[model samples]
Target chain A: MELVEKYLYAIGKKLPRKQKRDIVEELRSLIIDNLEDRVKEGEPTDEDISQILIEMGSPAEVAKKYCTGTQWLIGPQLYDMYLMMCKIVLGALLLGYSVSIVVSLFSSLSGSGFGQIMWYIAKNLLSIIPGILAAIGAVTLIFAIIERTSKKPLDIDFAEGGKWNPSKLEPIPKKEEVVKPIESILGIVFTVFVLVLFYFYRDKIGFYYMSSLGDNWVMVKIFSQSALRTYLPLWTISWVLSLGMYIWLLCIGKYNMLARVFEMIVSALNIGILFFMANGPHLFEFDKLGADFIDLQPAVDFLTNNQSTIFYILAVLSIFGLLANLGKLIVGKVKGRI
Target chain B: MGNNQHTTDGLIQELRRGTLVLSVLSQLKRPQYGYSLVQCLAQKGLNIEQSTLYPLLRRLEKQELLKSDWELTGTRPRRYYQLNENGKEMLQELSDEWNRLAEVVKKLTQEEEIK
Candidate 1:
């Protein structure tokens, strides 16, 4: 009686885990008991069991009494969709920034060059972080609505094949495909931590060099108060943007074309911003050159005056990093790792 | 059926829905298997869907109002259900409540009849 077995199996799919086996066994016996009582008068056929199953009603309706506590903001069913929305937002941000960089390159070929521009963008990475938080919030809000409004949670097959199997429940992610949400979250936290540190206690960035003369030590204030005050507004903007990148990474769990492009844009912008900031101010202070370091005073002063040059040099070196990530993104896309 | 009959069916189903647990509990004093319970209820002119009754029995069992066990009798296995101590207590309380409700309904219906 494959038909009868199939019916029991369908009903079995709906029962809670602990009670599934016992309920199925008891139900099977009941159905068989009914079948035998009917066939006592004559021979049994599949048709008889089919009629029995029909009278039993839907498996969902039967399963309803047994099921408990499915209410949630975004249950397992909508988790993937929520993640997708986050990816789309992040990807859009990345594309927008990349396009902006490309446009800037085309228009502004006269001043401070690519290196300075990239360094400027890199430094402002902090201000962009809040955008990530907002994107995640938006996705969560939409999914919460969907979860609440859905008439029947079971209407969507949260599990593949409409029945849960341990093997199929959570397939092992490939190395390249893993999202590393923890790492992304940590990076966001680190960024926020740095911002807080910079705001409250930034004068501690100088050098403590021991003099060769006689254990005489002197402290140099490397970072100026003006760095925090003047750049606070710009830093806030870039921090919010950086927050978006981290949040998108956390929510989406993995990088795709969009994330890669977003990364590229963010990297480019960061480098550019750092370069721009370098051009604007001393950015660093080495006023306490001491007696021994007076010979290097001219070099220190030149670097201090042209801090943007250092960022430009660093930005050129970071191109290798951006290229490597872009390569990984391309490869991951081809392999369906994304 | 017509719209009038549709409303009647829906209303009657709602009425029957409330009494299903009571109806099943009334008969679980003696051990009865799935088909046997269905036949017992059907014979008494209380029609319950076989699918409905089986799950209902399982739910009542879960609620500790009914207990069930599988028995191998004759050629095959059969699951026999009987009211447990909890079920007996519930049945008694529910029976008393049903009686009061039925009495009140009868009085009201008699008034309708008079009208």
Candidate 2:
């Protein structure tokens, strides 16, 4: 009985503090009672008592039986959601950090002083927004997982027979109650606002910036005259495409399947646009417009020096975003099944 | 002849087995110590093994159907068991159901035997 007490104590120590004492006392009483009954039946040997204890099963098994009720609050159902959130957050952070470092290096190499430094910092911060969101999401997901696994109130439903009868209990509103519609509305409003802003501010924004010119004689002359001209249209086109994609995503991306398909299409369009912009003029005979454009030296140098690197970076980021959306889609599918 | 007797005894045991739990529960409604309870039930023709009765008592206590209190009478302390509130309710329901089912079974079996 002393040995059994010691065994029970060891097992009880593993359990939560609140339950340990009652369980230990009950176990002790049971063992002693059994032992005394055995002794009266003429099986009074020490060896026999030890053999009986051994035959009854391990201390852990006994402890487990006592602790079996209400094992988890949210249960084992939401484990997949936790894992998916983890992947998204980690991937976002990795992508953000890499892009920040690369962009910072480019800005420093370009030698564009204090304004450029401020721009670099602002851009990096903006780029890291998704990463920060991912981190917060990951932390929340971990808390949710812990809450699910712990057999606590608010998450646990402890009725006999393993069926979730919601009619028996009150329901709490879900997180998506406020955020989902708000997010969709904000996304659409922001996209439309940016488009309008760009349309109205085009001239003011591009006044000193000579790269807004089309492929006319005057525009060719302007391009030949200015070193920044060739790069401006490229930036404008890229920005418009990005904004277009954002609006498209906001409009049609409520469903995971549609969002994933849209993401793929946008990713492909980005790559295709970058490819054409990098090599378009050479194939289109825009080089043969006049003497001013015929040289093509300034435009070629500008495109050669900057286009490939910029396009490569954008392509990578877009692919990363696409992969993140894909991750979201897979998570949604898994969550649906669960 | 002894083998035939043993077979008949085993058949009787099997036939009477389902009533053992109800019989034990009914006795424990009145506060009774373990050994005394066993002797009392045996006198009523519901003979049960000590091993089986002890475990069943413990299980009932665990299920909150039985309550026990230890009283030291003479040299050794004896644990007395009694039916709890839940146990009383369950016992009443079980008794009612058993009577109804037994009557139906008796009617059917008697009619078949007559035919």
Candidate 3:
């Protein structure tokens, strides 16, 4: 009787809350019925009861038949995607954090030693961990809900897609038109690198002209903080367009007329934005640059006085570069070279 | 186990699983409690695990093929199951299908034997 009660309790624990009481009662009665029948001829000992329960099977195995729902937080269906998301997010976080920490530390290397720099980076990485964990938790929760609701596995391939039609497959990319995955991936990395660069290390950018401050020659940037702010919006749109084009190339894996035209449009927009920023208020901010050092006086005077001329030179160069690429792409399309 | 023995066991297990419902329905014309049905089927040489039978019985009842009620039989309460109208119809259709399948299997095996 003691053994039977314990066995019932074990199985009862595994039962779902909604149907627990009734299921437990039914299971208990079955056990008692089987037990009473076993010793009907004579009163049995505890050994007999235990032996009978043993033949019936373990509590977990018996309960498993009644409880078919999986208990895992993320089931097998969504595990691959969960793993992949974590890899991508954590990889980017680590890469960007390390780069920024190094740049920020290197800029202000006056009082801090190597150990201090290392400690600062280590502390910052630890501080950002909660944000990373929050991101991971959100991804896991979304996937877990999907795993429960989604009936089919999430690995349906392009050719084996649920609604795939043979006619939907495009023609094989021509040799010249083939968008190499390595090239497209490099483009995406470059765009992402620039995003990280401007977001964290914007001050580190621009011409770091070596100028004498007393006996020491320190690097001074020609573009002031205000000048960088003027370029921010232009840089943002260019970054977005570049990233978008990279994704489009990755998905299509070829140079179609649509992609070529999109690239051309983005290049035109960037060129226009560059010229507009060059002609904006306080382009070089020579009045401000004059205070940096006496040694940079000549360079600053020439830059400030000839600011429009220098900007026009830059604007014309970028225009020529973009126009040449556009011409090459058009010629390639016409000749089926790309 | 030998590959031939493994194949036979798998085939027999599948065959038993497919026909388990039909066998249970045929015996459920009269109301029977869980253990009683287990013994009744055992006597007819269709032994099933007690654990498997209980859930299968509940599922069939939930599906409306079987109707169950709790009755105080002797000292303890027992859940007795009886076939519903749906169960009776299902049993007849399954019985016909079983006959057809058995005949096909017999003819196929006989041809294999000759080969």
| Clash count per candidate | 44, 0, 0
Give the distance in Å from residue A101's predicted Cα in candidate 1 to where it truly belongs: 12
lDDT of 3 by residue, A12-32 (tens): 898788877887788778877
TM-score winner between candidates 1 and 2: 1
Model 2 DockQ class? incorrect
DockQ of all candidate complexes = 0.35, 0.07, 0.58
Instruction: Score each candidate by Cα lDDT.
Output: 0.73, 0.59, 0.76
On TM-score, the leading prediction is: 3
Candidate 2 local Cα displacement, residue A121, angstroms:
29
Q: Can you tell me the CAPRI class of model 3?
A: medium
Model 1's CAPRI class?
acceptable
Please write out the lDDT profile of model 2 over residues A1-338, one tens digit for every residue.
56676777777876667857755654555556667656776645767667656754566666554554557533455554445444434543554455445434443334456677677767876866775776666567665666766554433465558766667663443443222534544543444344433343222221111122422212221122132344345545555555555444433334335555765775766666666555443221222234434465666556546755666677777778878867877786799699
Model 1, B2-112: lDDT tens digits are 579888999999999999999899998999887888999999999988767777787788789988888887877778889999999999998899999999999999999
Q: For candidate 3, list the clashing residue pairs, or say none.
A: none
Of the true interface contacts, the fraction found in model 2 is: 0.00
Models sorted by TM-score, best on top: 3, 1, 2
* Angstrom error at residue A253, model 2: 12
Q: Cα lDDT for residue A191, model 2?
A: 43
By summed lDDT, the worst window of 10 consecutive residues in model 1 chain A runs over A101-110
lDDT of 1 by residue, A111-138 (tens): 4556887775674455456756776787
